[model samples]
Target: MTNPMRFNARIFDESFLDQCDERISAFYLMWKAKCKEGRIPARSDFDPLDMVKFLPGITLVDVERDTLELTYRLVGTNEVAVRGNDPTGKKVKDTFLANNWEDVWGNYSHVIKNKGVAFDDSDMPNSNGVMVGDETIFVPLSQDGEFVNMVMLYSIQRKAAG
Candidate 1:
């Protein structure tokens, strides 16, 4: 069997947003309303396992006062794992050596500043230090459309089967 990670690459497309059917738009609108109500928690409400079930390549990120945290699930043929980490929780520096926070922070900062969505295709290095092809999308969420409070991210990586 081939183990391929099918991430949510298309979610970042502007045209896709424009063409978002009623179902998707309704979902986004519901999320937006939740953000407005300040009901969304820093932690995800959706089950990590559901991410693997429906959106195998999707990842979520939370933007706190001065940090970016990641909540993700790994789906493989045999096992699954859900992990959460705050790459820059205490200091202004990144905690994880495997992540390039410089680039990621800059990109996320841009999205926050613009109060919009950002998309990019790049090679991400995993824990093993091997570069994996990935597609990422960042969406800024705000209460007043001025300060970005949260940024949602979805990514997918393609890997070869052993």
Candidate 2:
């Protein structure tokens, strides 16, 4: 059997980062503008809600030297407001179950390592056993395109009426 980690690694595209360079650049510009306007103090000054203004399905992750962490806020009508699943200051591994967690972390790791953006779509099973299609974009955060630290954005897709 293949290792679960290996399986998770395949979900991300190698060139996904290259495709999102412009969007990620815009994000950085926004961050810089916020900082100049005194809306931000440090990297921690970012709020997931701020991202929703541009991307509804935005999520954030903080990467330290030893650990990968996810910071997000559940938004949109499709997302069930689960108790105690606050995205801010929480790791994705700690927030999700083993099966789901691996896939989520894998994408985050991919973006960080590639120092680029990644995109994916999947059908997720919810607490009520309902299947929801989720579309996400993972963007790497770096000042000079050298040191990668965090990922931002996790957008979900809504089904259209037939």
The candidate that achieves the highest lDDT relative to the unseen native structure: 2
Model 1 bad stretches (over 4 Å): 1-59, 64-92, 96-100, 144-146, 159-162
Cα-based lDDT for every prediction = 0.45, 0.49
Which consecutive 10 residues in model 2 have the weakest lDDT in total?
1-10
Error of 1 at 126 (Å): 2.0
Instruction: Please provide, for model 2 over 1-162, each residue's C-alpha lDDT reduced to its tens digit, 9 standing for 90 to 100.
Output: 111111212335434444333554455456545444322233455675676555443555666745545554333333323222344555566665225665667777777776545666554444444444444566566543455566665554444112
lDDT of 1 by residue, 42-86 (tens): 334445553443253344444565644432222232111212333
| Residue ranges of candidate 2 with Cα displaced over 4 Å | 1-52, 68-84, 160-162
Best by TM-score: 2
